[model samples]
Target: MTAILSVSDLTVAYGGVTAIDGVSLSVDDGEIVTVLGANGAGKTTLLLAIMGAVPASRGRIALRGTDVSRSRAHHRLAQGLVLVPEGRQVLVSLTVEENLLLGAHLRRDRQAVRNEIAAIYERFPNLGQRRHTAAATLSGGEQQMVAIGRAMVARPQVLMLDEPSLGLSPLFVSKVFDLIEEMNRSGLTIVLVEQNTGKALSVAHSATVLELGKVAIAGPSEALRNDHRLLEAYLGGAADIADEPSSMRANSQ
Candidate 1:
């Protein structure tokens, strides 16, 4: 199958510092591709650039076969490319249902949008139960659910997630990974940027390791999992990839 999303020689810079350099990767239709790296590894920069949040110094971004390298972020969203950013940037002041409705702000089909929101509530019962609750009052895990649900409300074909597992309890991490796999199984193409190497590799069909603005290692997740040296050098140590949580494995399978 042709790649649903493609990034070629992508580069992003801030004044004299280059965050991402010549990074290229592709996500196939219905595949989960994870990008792994330590802090400042250009992982987030790549995603931001792809989302058109950060201007690319060089490179091309394509959705399906269309070049959208210069498209605005909203334009990309209109093309079914959506990014659920890091930090669970939910509108804190708004109610959970209100925040979800904002995700469909670009849509004119009000009735269909309402139906999609209902569907999201069905998938995430917690959001449904707390629909009228202000997003700020929700716990971290609950807020993360709101973030994912908000992105789902946008109805993206290719979902790029930046650090979905960050700052969450172990239990919430497991829940997030399970939800990710569920979304993938339900036919969403995911490009994940995650710091939890073990969990990321566990659920990813393929993996890419970024170091100092370039791809240090890239291949099938199983192969990358066994490459202890690469993991040690770029991911702190080989032990980082050792703990493959049973929940993650189950979800991936």
Candidate 2:
């Protein structure tokens, strides 16, 4: 499979501290690649670096084989590389629809944008029901859906999500994971940084566990999932129990 997104020996530093050190991973076209780690392990930093939100002190980043190491965040977004940041960074004062519209600001086809937003509403009926409601009034999970929708409007070929399930209720978390599986099934490539290690593993085709700013283990998701000791030793948080069997089946079949 051709890699849609690739990072080689990437490193990022904050002042004197190196956030991501010599990390490398690849997300194949239409495959879900997961990044898992404990706090301060630089999981979020890896996603930001890949999206060009943070400068890489060393190493290279490529999207669909095109080098984008020095590109700006907006430029990366225009290249179909998008990031749904860790905290649902929605414009609180804006209505749900308005916030989603912001994602297509760079798009020239107003009609296409409208169509895309409609598709987003179709996927998240709750958002459709509250399209006119202020984003601040929505629940945490709703805000997360809005954030993901906004990224979707940008027409991302590779979507990188940072700790998507953080601080959500179990009900919402399940919904979010289901949405992820549904999107991946439709041929969207995803690089997911998730705290729910078990869910992440089951959804991903491959996974890389970051440890203290470097890759501790990287392999097929099934291989890692079965190695419970390796996961428990390196995975930063408690793994959730839910496993979407269909997602795993997609890989084995």
lDDT of 2 by residue, 1-253 (tens): 9998889999999999999999999889999999988767898888888888788999999998999998998999999998999887999999999999999988999999999899989888999999999999999889999999999998999999887887777788888889999999999999998767778888999999889999998999999888877876886324433242322222110
Score candidate 2 by TM-score against the native. 0.93
TM-score, each model? 0.93, 0.93
Which ranges of candidate 1 are over 4 A from the true structure?
A: 241-253
* Reference-based lDDT, each prediction: 0.86, 0.86
> Candidate 1 on 1-253: residue-level lDDT in tens?
7799999999899999999999999899999999987777888889889999999989999999899999999999999999988888999999999999888988899899889889878877888898999999998788988899889888899999988877777788888999999999999999998877788888999999899999998899988887777788887663454464422422110
Model 2: lowest-lDDT 10 consecutive positions: 244-253
